[model samples]
Target: MAMAMAKLWMYCLLVCLGMALNNVASAQGVNPFEPDGGRRREMVPAMFIFGDSLIDNGNNNDLPSFAKANYFPYGIDFNGGPTGRFSNGYTMVDEIAELLGLPLIPAYSEASGDQVLHGVNYASAAAGILDITGRNFVGRIPFDQQIQNFQTTLDQLADNLGAIEAAEALGKCIFFVGMGSNDYLNNYLMPNFPTRNQYDGQQYADLLVQKYNQQLRTLYNLGARKFVLAGLGRMGCIPSILAQSTAGSCSEEVNQLVLPFNANVKTMMNSLNANLPGARFIYVDIAHLFEDIVANARTYGFSVVNRGCCGIGRNRGQITCLPFQTPCENRDEYVFWDAFHPTEKVNIIMARKAFNGDPSIVYPINIQQLANL
Candidate 1:
């Protein structure tokens, strides 16, 4: 009875807190849950994306890689249809671009000439911090290569707008980067790779941060000032990891493995902000944001959390969604779109939260505040 009463009190406390937050939103005349809530006109001049499949857009469409998603079912709900995006609809960055009052940032592979003036997305499927990270996927562009591609884009901008104007434009743009998941999913965890036999989890995290630090510095040198670094989400809770579980539960071991990486990256944020003058870095707490959505799945209108909306075997994760495969009718109710990615609804929620959420979700300041700065 005591335990039950304690639980009840905790529940009531959460309810009261939610009500208070809602009341604050009402008083301020800005509903955070709404899409247009805190949008104060166009925020950033442009947004340049660099990451893995989570925000790839269409960089892998023409690449001879197995990780490409330019087929049916992948973009069944999307207006363009299978534009190399892993999700059925929009990626998190796509939603973020819209929130910033800009059109979808074109992929680096496809954008040409003045098309990249607004910004360019160099994210690719199966890319990682390490250059040799995604060798299994023959044609995937690694993080270093992506940076080189951005340099090429910068040259193009310089040629078109002159060096001074290009520098000023890029300074006001947002650099949205979400990497490291492939380092864990494709390199560290894969049996085919020898990453695990290499350094242990802590050592690996250090190596990644060490390399990532230099890479970010390169981007800073190239004129990127406002940086939004999205940390790894709960990879162990995804359908691919859960499918490997006999008990059909999230892989706690896998979760613990990546914790150090996120912590180190968070610590690195303060270092970058302090050391790199004119460079403002903000860390997005993807792990916590994903956890809250899963924990409160019902409240968020999600019914299926452990399995993918479209896949083959146990938890529908043995194989990723195939071409022409029909997905769940209720896409909004399903959290996982494939064995490894989230649905469009989930993307919208995450983008919104990171854009305007409190300090707990996005440290130092959220995306909106960072843009204004």
Candidate 2:
């Protein structure tokens, strides 16, 4: 045990020294990791993703739930047709994986054997931060359950590569978490659920932030060192929320409800970065980015900002895109793909922004910078 502690200490010391040298090289406008030809290489060892349908690749297909999306028009543009991704093509994490020079991370439900070595996506449709948040969906994997799945993956990895080696590999990988949207969309805002009557918006945000802190700490304890926590996007402008509006406009009330949650999460991220040893945390200002895209829809080549490409009723959101439904001809010019999710184009833009955009949107540092560190 003493020998193991000494070895861990020596490894940490060397990592810190290397980071310091990298910072110096960065200040001199030179990237030590980059070759002369500027070819992109895998930035991190691997990327483990956790979130809801926004990033869920295929974790909900086998589950007996209403949130399943492994059918037509869902993965219409993907090379692998109808692979359970909520979007038409790639998700935000898929884009990030591509930008990182890594293949798309497979879903936890589908990942097997050596596939687990690269990474696994535990995000599920309708999953939320709180355990009870997604009960309406009946079979969704909440944040806690997702972590358990990751633990199972870790056990498999440990059997393949010894415990110490697995830990070392995980420490160098990226942990991307984009939860909490379902906590609001599927729980707090749902009339059948008593979340609204139980607590006001601010109190609910506080409760979520508290629980999220615990959940993230649990990951840190299990060898996750680098984290990218994506903040909730502009839910008010979503097709579903917009459909509820009498006038054809964004719902300010709904948008205001999510502000506290995003703000609290940012505070929690800063606290975690300060408190956790060897752990780094960054926040993605998803709301701001979404708003920017909506505000300048034309600039981003999006024409329809208030309706879905394949949904029905008002704003094409009252009923989500039905199975076998034909999507819009100009899929590239739409902001939303369904009532609750954005189009692949929008996902690509969001991923690009979070990957290398300015620090104002992706707080502290972007994904590329986080990978380098």
Candidate 3:
């Protein structure tokens, strides 16, 4: 009994020493590993992704949303075929997961207690920052609903691993928010509502930014410390917008309208950093990266930057690729796979850049660095 007591005392002493070291490291502005949360083989213990079709994966499969892509050709290049990813293969988050040494995280609806310990994806196709953004697509999960689901996931996390352990793990994880495109495509531009009349372009963007800031704060309250907020790309450069232009050039008018949203988002990230203690926010500049790709298509090994690899109208942006539609023979040569999404190859490129690109693309820090933090 004496020997056992001695051993217990030694262990306690070692644990206390470790805690002191960690506290010192943290005080010096460095992230030190926690005893329970830092044992993972991956850079990040887990990644909780929240967004729209850009990183949907398969969450919208059962959401009754017409904005689903759980069909053939959508995932023709991905494993298990049509896993509901909007891209031909892996989505942006999928590539990031692979780089982080994790398997594809299960969708929120498909994940259970233990399965969610690794992570859960709350992204849904057609979902946006605004609740009514994707309402046209019947049954879409809005941003608010996604956050509620995340709360549910948090409850499950606490249940599975105990509250302390679960919270620790989440602190070491990544929270990626890639929504807002649909707020423009499916809401502002949609003529059904009086949104256009209610607020001009810049006013509408400011409104979205205000709501986005609140949503992000809600996530922080839910234990998300590291945030990856994707800024909007050039909406007018997509095939759908190009089809609307008689000259087949980008609609500069639409482009200017969308610029303020991205600017506001960057400002929000800065504000979040200043106001939220211990929070790290990284902004992704998709517009600049996209413009570079289109401007230097040949240099980037892309043969077509103005048209979709699979579609029916001018530049193939008039309508989304239909079921069984024949895709281009050289998919890698096209910047876009469909009217609305990038090809698998482009997804890989973007993921690689975001993982380790310069400040021009991923400002403040790259995803790899974000994961480490």
Model 3 regions lying over 4 Å from their true place: 1-39
**lDDT on C-alpha atoms for all candidate structures:** 0.89, 0.90, 0.85
Candidate 2, superposed: residue stretches over 4 Å from native: 1-40
Provide backbone clash counts, one per model.
0, 0, 0
Candidates 2 and 3: which is better by lDDT?
Answer: 2
- Candidate 1 deviant stretches above 4 angstroms: 1-41
C-alpha TM-score for every candidate: 0.89, 0.89, 0.88
Over 81-133, each residue of candidate 3 has an lDDT whose tens digit, in order, gives 88788877888888888888777888987887556766789999889888888
Candidate 2 lDDT, tens digit per residue, 228-304?
99999889989999899888688888889999999999999989999999999999999989989988999999999
TM-score of 3: 0.88
TM-score of 1: 0.89
Whichever of 2 and 3 has more TM-score, that candidate is: 2
Worst 10 residues of 3 by lDDT: 30-39
